[model samples]
Target: MAKKDYYQILGITKSAEEREIKKAYKKLAMKYHPDRNQGDKTAENKFKEIKEAYEILINEEKRTAYDQYGHAAFENGHSNNTYSTFTSSSDFSDIFGDVFGDIFGGNRTKRAKKGSDLCYKMEILLEEAVKGTKKEIHIPTLQKCKKCHGSGASIGTKPYSCSTCNSKGQIHIRKGFFTVQQSCPTCQGRGTIIKHPCNGCHGQGRVETYKTLLVKIPPGIDDNDRIRLNNEGEAGSNGAQSGDLYVQISVKKHPIFEREENNLYCEVPINFTMAALGGEIEVPTLDGRVKLKIPCETQSGKLFRIRGRGVRSMQNRNQGDLLCRVVVETPVNLNEQQKNLLHELGKSFNDFRGENNSPRSKRFFDGVKRFFDDLTR
Candidate 1:
């Protein structure tokens, strides 16, 4: 019988990209693998077909020849015979690991272990976040044992090659036509065994210790920013590379000012006289206080912006504006004379009648009247 098209066997088009071809092959190979579908001869045959299709389509030269002459290109021994026979489980793992290593952490062939990364949360004041500061932090982590020097062996002794796996760190198990490779149970993939364990850290090459580090925070760093310190985390086993330490920053809420990006916002309460007559008022900024000029007849909830009085940008050193929202505070605890004077002032405004000084209040009352009139109509 004529062989099926490679693309059709892998359920992909002939114009499929390399990534698409690999993805389809991986899916089908996992689904029909003999190890996963044990005792099913149909699945075993299907897996072989998928593997053959992938092997040809993934290679430029083989694909070119196969595209021109189909399977007849390899019938009389023209092919390299790379995949003609399945010899060992290592060969199967090599092909599978090449495509899926990143998805499954890393290649299983690599037995060296790196130290685990660590995270530390540090809270700072808003002022500190804007101005930048240095802080010392204490972290409890694992450090390499001084006596054993991360080797896990006692004085005058060193680790020996694992007898179970012959120091290769992996063991192969053959089941029928399929074979599986796994880390050696005795050495745990370390490829070495310690006869005399270190007294300082037992068999483990690390000990619990507290580490102190000084972290320098950058100016204008916002909340939830992360600063990484390289190789400051737990010590790696067997002399592998150490991990990193990530310091996460949390800015505390300020009582007066709220920050949005580089800008600063604050609600400033002003007396009714100042709101109406206009005056210079003091507003707080990250850099001391600044005077903000309020225009005459300024209404409540009016915003006044002071340029270059806000937080500076860490990237470019550009400063932002400070926005002050004015809230008119009503006079309270008035004496009898003050109350009478206010009453007279209020009457004077009404006596002007045609002036319409309070246009917002007039428009609001007009809308209310129209609503009631519509209801009556």
Candidate 2:
């Protein structure tokens, strides 16, 4: 008799994905498995058909040949003769292992687990962030026991194989038609038990102790940046690999300067005479004091840019510019003689007339007059 179509046998379309094919096979295998069906001949035949269809379609090379030549690709002494034979119970067990491994913890191999990671927050001054510095931090963490060398066994003693799981670290429990594997209860999946525990750690293989670590802060590090120190976290159990430490940095506020990226900004107070008449004045920078030249007729809120006087770049060695905003200071608490001299100076400028000495104030008042006239109209 001619064989049935593979896609029709699996109840899937030719365009079905590999995962869909596996899913359909799993569903049918569960329903018609010989173990589930007992002595039913019809279910056994149907299970064989499903298994044969899955074997051909699951293999890329066989599926390609079957798609081109149909069932003839496996007939007449072809290398694909393996699909004609029904698989044994061992094959079903391998399939079950692949499908239910994660749910039942069926992995047989045992490996040591790494220690847990740790996080530490460090606060530093803005100056320290701008310039690199080293700091030592003290942390309380789990360290491997010195007396037992992380084995949890006392002197002249050792760990023995677990009796519950026979040192397999896992136990298999048969549930009807399926076998579920879980961690051994006695050893907690460690596969061994310490015969005599060390006095220091009491069978934990680690002890809580204070450790000092030195961390180097890189230059030009901004606030909220992080530095990772590998293998500096809690000690691992039973000679496993240690975890890592993360250091979070926070920069403090500066009194005189505000930093944005690589630039620094500050406001400088300038006398009214200096604004009216050009002069050189001293200003503060990160490096030291520097002379700033203010041109004649300089107004309040005028910004001055000084090259290479700002924060340095972390990636490259390039320096940034500094921005200084000038605010003209008004004279106050004048004596009688000073007031008389100021009055004489003000009279010389013809305050009542349209004098251009204070051009900004004159234009502002003229604009206000025009606004009022328009409102009346």
Candidate 3:
């Protein structure tokens, strides 16, 4: 049978853009790759077909010719056979270097790679988060070598232009009927070579050192917050731009409080007497101790909201509220006299049960009775 249409196999129209072509090719290649399919003959054939199709489509000139003349253009030798071109890995480096230069400022191929970014994780107390604080950190990183001043060469000498590429840092290779441009082997892709290397950094231009920086943690900053300091990263070779430093913030666990967004939650233990006869109590807050009133006959797990007592967000002026959950504490380690007094109190509340007793408990027991009665029926 005749071969399937290449465009149809890759699922694209002739008018597809470069990105679309690459996307389609990558999908098909991954699906039928020889390494993935192993002994599957059909998959192997499909892989080769797609590879050939992509090779033609990715090259503008060859793609145009294939579209106009079909496969006959290659058989008749009427078009340039760019698909048969063989390029060295170095050549690919130069092409990417030029492309990266246009996309990100300056040619990366011509300069030493920038140092990697560094992250410093810091833990701050809840009080510190409420009112911003500054901290100093020491980090080890690669800095520009002072001896050679980032040149990677002796003090009196500089790198010389590579002769292989005539300082262009690229070379054209011809294979079969095609030509592909790649980097020059002699100078890699930097176009220059060091004649006398620096002794301090061994020609790398950067050295390992420890650096100190002052990081400011903003107020209201929450856990896992990140702050970035630009150009504070490791030094780049040949005096290229340095990397960046990132400070990650983590809030230490509070002894008496839990944080959620801008809000604060705390559990306050109230004595049984306080729950029985409501009174004022002191609660701890970031600012200071604040007075909170407890109503008479208050029960455990009662939440009290304190407005404007939580956090003030860095971005907004509105402050958050503090939530206090009350837990009635039972008297513990009581003496004989205390036990007798409690027993008298219990006798006084003996008639507090049933309909006139705790109304909530009575209602809950009534619900349970109705539920079991329905189940039995």
Q: Which ten residues in a row have the lowest lDDT in candidate 3?
A: 84-93
- What residue pairs are clashing in model 3? 90-183, 91-182, 91-183, 352-357
User: What does candidate 2 score on TM?
Assistant: 0.75
lDDT of 2 by residue, 160-278 (tens): 99988788777776666676667888888888888799998998788999999999999888889899999898889876878999999998888988888988899999988899998
lDDT of each: 0.84, 0.84, 0.79
Candidate 2 minimal-lDDT segment of 10 residues = 80-89
Tens-digit lDDT track for model 1 on 20-120? 88888777877787667778889888888888998899888988898899889988879766655223465556445555553455445434578999999
Ranked candidates, highest TM-score first: 1, 2, 3
* Tens digits of lDDT, candidate 3, 307-377: 99998988876799899999999889999999999888767666444565477877887899999999999
Name the candidate, 2 or 3, with the larger TM-score value. 2
Local distance difference test, candidate 3: 0.79
Comparison by lDDT, 1 against 3, better one: 1
> RMSD per prediction, one decimal?
5.7, 5.3, 9.2
